[model samples]
Every structure is written in C-alpha cells, then in structure tokens.
Target: MQVLLDTLAPADAPRVADPRALTDEDLLALYAPPQQTWLRVNMVSTVDGSATGDSGLSGSINNPADGRVFATLRRLADVVVVGAGTAKAEGYSPTDTPIVLVSRKAQVPESLRGAPAGSVLMATCSLSDGIGEARELLGEEHVLTYGSHRVDLPALKAGLAERGWGHILCEGGPHLLRDLVFQGAADELTATTVPRLVAGSYPRITVGAPLDAHLTLRLLLEDEGTLLGRWFV
Candidate 1:
C-alpha cells in the first residue's frame, strides 16, 4: 500500500501554511481508484472528550456538519456495516448503501425490521436463531450467517463479493472497530476529530490492544472544526 498526504503549501516558498482548511472528501481523492477496496471508520467525541452520553448515544457527539460528512461517506460505500448493539441503540435504518449488522446471536430489533427492502444483511454466528423479522420483512436471502466464534472476515468479504458488494464502510460503536483492527482487516482508516473534548467515564475509540509498533498516519486534512487523518496498514 501507499500513503498520501494532501495539504496546501505556500506557493512562494516550500513551506506549509494553514492545515485546517481542507475537507476529508478533498483529501480522499489522493487514493488511487476510489472504487477499489476501501473502508472508513468514523467516531465522534464531545469538546470534553466524551464519546457517548449518559444514555449511551453517539448522536450527542455528532453535529449537523458531521452528519452530512457521514451521509456522504455512506453514499460512497457499497456496504455499510455496524454492530447489532449499535444498530439497536442508534435506531439505524438501511441507507443508500446496503446495511450489514454484526451480531453473534442474530438479535435484531423489531423496529428496524423494515430496513429499506433488499438493502439489509444480518451477519450472525448462529443459524438456529432464524431470520425472524428480517426474513418475512426484508427477504430471506438478505440475512447472512458466519462463524460461531470470530467472524471469518475474509470469507465474508468473498461472500459479499459474490453478491456484488465491493466497497465496505464500517461505522463503529468501538468494539467492532477494535475487532477489525485486531484482525488486521481494516485496510484504510479515515478519522475526523472535532475540536472539542468531552471527558467522562464512557468509552472512547477502541482498537483492542495497543499497537506493538505505532501505526503511522498521514495528516490528510484539517478543517475549521475537524481534522481528517488517514492510515494504511
């Protein structure tokens, strides 16, 4: 893999200028063949460093600008993935991209049963749980079952490819991100850090364990209230 840092420099001299003027979308163009295999992990925190609220909601950390950026990223992905716990807590619905929920027990909320026909994929470890609402509502074929232990991510990717899914985007609730990072399944990481801190006992971004060797990231862009960093591992 290759790493690219897209930043504006002074025209007169070979010096760097302001870094907080470029957007993540502008920096993403540096990646060759945007349609190629790519995954984006997104997280939001408050000005005090808190990632979640008392009710365990990430929406508290997100603003209107963040929402727009998220939606745009979702549009670029072929499959949008999240943990089932996150789906239930966030009340997620199928968007433009197909939805994939990672659940060991295949426990899906009845409210999300109507997830935009043909755009839902439930990834579960157990086959005995049955599709339940996903079957009668979203069609039987939309549900996918994987290993009972750790998910065979490579196999899942191959399966998704067979079903015509190439680009995958992972929107996290921390634990899922940690698993992906630990498994070395994440090819690329796009993180937007807002200029705020929310200090609390709640959890922040999870990466399973501390890296033995630091994973280097290129500073892609930094806008007024956000900083976009990219890493290739």
Candidate 2:
C-alpha cells in the first residue's frame, strides 16, 4: 500500500468539510504494511460521541462507506482478535482471516461457537471450562491457552508468527482494545468518525488505564466525514 499524509487543524476544531473523501483509493494504496509484527485497532463512532447503540451494537455506528473501509481493513489482516463478549454481542463469524477470541473466563456464546473449518482460535487462561464441544466443532488446533494471570503478548505474537500470521487486527468492544493498548501492544488505530450524532454515555474507542507514554499519530486521510489516523508505538 502507498503512504499518504494530511494535516488536521486540531482535535477541538469545528467541523469543516467532510474528511471521508480524502480516504479514497489513492490514499489506501499508500498504506504501508508494518515491518516485523504489527497490530491495528479498528473502530467507528458517531460525531456526537457514541460507539454503539442503546442495544450495544456497533452495526448502527456506520454507513455503507464505513462498511467498505471496515471490510478492506479486515482483508488486510492475518488474524482478527475480539473479546468473547464482543463476539457474542455482535454475532461474529469467522472471516477470511483467522478469528481469535480472548476470554479469561471461557464464556463464548454458543451461537458464535464454531469456527469456519480450521480458522478459529480461542485464547483463555484456564482449562477448567472444558472446550470439548468447541474442540469438536473447530478442531483441536483452533483452541489455545495462556493459562496465566497476565498473558505473554510477545510470546503469543511469536507463536502467531510461527504460524505465518504477522499482521493482527483487533475489532473490539473496549475491554480488548484497552488491554492491547495498556500492554503497549497496539501499533496503529483506524477510526471512522461518522457524520451523524448519537448522544449517550456509550463507549468510546479506547477505554482503560491512561497510557504512561504519549501516543503520537499522523493524519493519513480524511473523506466524507471520516478520518483515518496512524500511530507508531
């Protein structure tokens, strides 16, 4: 992908023209793949600051254009990670990339249970909750465990790399994103800010303990009310 750069006045500036148009094919072509291991967090939110609906679904946070960008991001990922709560709430299915679920308590919903053939992976901290059914449904290689109070992120990344997965994408429900950011594991964040406003006390993109270090980002592209920013850790 190509690399494109732009400047936004400031985060507190008033809205001018829609920014989504700047994220055209030309800009997307300029995006460079990260060297070594990489991870990106993707999210969409309303102008009025809501990440989901009253029913807690992100599906209502985007339009067709946003959906297109979301699909493109997914297509570029080697693995997609989400919390089990998100998987259940969003009724997630395994996509072209391998689906990874992070559950400290092994509470993955039955509806979003099975993986597509050999493409699902579950990361848990314990084996007390037998994965017998999940193993049968997704095959043995699909289930994984860290079995520790704190996961070894570097080790997990190495393991994924050994399996030929270097670019990981995180589609979250806040908690998972928080963990990744808190652990200093996320490389970039791609957020789509929609034109409409949905006022509420709903979630924002990153929710967790404040970062000890500042996260610096460059504005990559803006179009039709959407802004894409890239950050380096």
Candidate 3:
C-alpha cells in the first residue's frame, strides 16, 4: 500500500512516511483504533458510487489491495458485527475472531449452521422469534437481545464492550450500516474506491432511512486506480 494523503503530520512530513514498503503487520497496527471501545466500518464502492457490481457483490468490483486491507481490518477488530443478509450473501464462515450477527428477527441463516458454537453470535431484539434456535446453535451467552421490537444499536455496542469486545467492526449490508449511523454508534469508516464504473440501481454503502452522521478524513492511500480512505465519524 502507498500513502497518498494523511493528516497525522504537516503536508511535508507525514507521520507514516515510509522510505520502504510497509509490511502487513505494520499496516494492521496503523489501522488499529486509539481506544478499545471504538467502532470502525469497512466498505467498498465502485467509482459510480454503487456498492455492488455485475456480480451483485462488492468482491466483483474490489481489487487485490482492497482484499489485503479487508484482512488487516478483520485482524484488528475484536468482534465483527455483520448483518444476516451480508453474512449469507458473502458466504461468511466462522473465523478465529468472533462474529456478531445483527438482526431484527434473529434468524440464523443456514450458511452459519456449521459454525462452531460460541464462534458466532446473534444480536437481535427482545421480541425476536429465533432466540431458542440461536441459543441452541450458538451458546446462550452468544445470543444477545436488546430493544423490545427493534435491535438497539447503542445497547448492542455496550453489550459487546462489556464483554471486552470493544473494538467493534461492522461489515454492513447497507441497511445495517444505515442503522449504525442513525444510532450514532460508528466511530470511523474505511472506504476503498475501486475505479470501476458499475452504473445501476445497486445500493450505496449506506441505505434505509436518512442519517446525519458526521465524518472527518484521516488517511488516504492509493494503489493504481484504487483509493483507500479512512474517516473518523
């Protein structure tokens, strides 16, 4: 990865200024948040501002550099908060790191049926119907419920923090990202711009109801036509 713009130091001397290439370890360390209770969002979008490409997935549009950053971000996170739609669409499997699936209905998709117990969690509303299923498949401690009929984003964050999973990472499926922003739970965002034009009615990074979450640019990187950026929310 190449540093294009960074606000860490003056324009002349960037704090991450490197004469040699950065190793994967160094890169992951640099992406880590300042505090434990930080929430970071990771997303990829095409040049035309669409989140999906011809394959109806971001992977079709994202390049190798984006994949590398994606892996690094996952390593830095304590818990990966994802939506069931994305978990299934992306064919997510259990990893060494825990995965928190946020849903209103608490439905555990079939794709996650093979996941080892306690490796995956379900974050849902109190009135959700799949509590018993989730608790049986994933351990009881892994099934977290907050609001009565709607998933409380803030409460979910707090619950994760209480369990020492403070470094929250959200790999959204649009609507979940919108809810995170609307609930003011997101602390930072990493958006990689793949220089491909996929002009269609595909969703952007954020969807659902409107939100007013503010963000400030922190770092900018480039690899050929791809631009990787990080912003503080």
- Highest lDDT: give the candidate number: 3
Output the lDDT of residue 207, model 3. Answer: 88
lDDT (Cα, tens digit) per residue for candidate 1, span 110-162 = 65676677777777654536557545665778777667565666556667767
Top candidate (TM-score): 3
Cα RMSD of predicted structure 2: 5.8
Worst 10 residues of 3 by lDDT: 13-22
TM-score, prediction 3: 0.93
Model 1 earns a TM-score of 0.77
Of 1 and 2, the candidate ahead on TM-score is 2
User: What root-mean-square deviation over C-alphas does model 1 reach?
Assistant: 5.1
Per-residue alpha-carbon lDDT of model 2 for 1-233, expressed as tens digits? 12235433445652334443334443344334446577778888888778886777899777765676676777677888788888888888766678877776655567656546767787665453655655665666776766465554555656676788887878886877777777767777777777777787888876777766466665554556565556554
lDDT values of the candidates? 0.64, 0.67, 0.85
Predictions ranked by lDDT, top down?
Answer: 3, 2, 1
TM-score list, all predictions: 0.77, 0.80, 0.93
Comparing 2 and 3 on lDDT, the stronger one:
3
Worst lDDT window (10 residues) for model 2? 1-10
lDDT of 3 at 210: 70
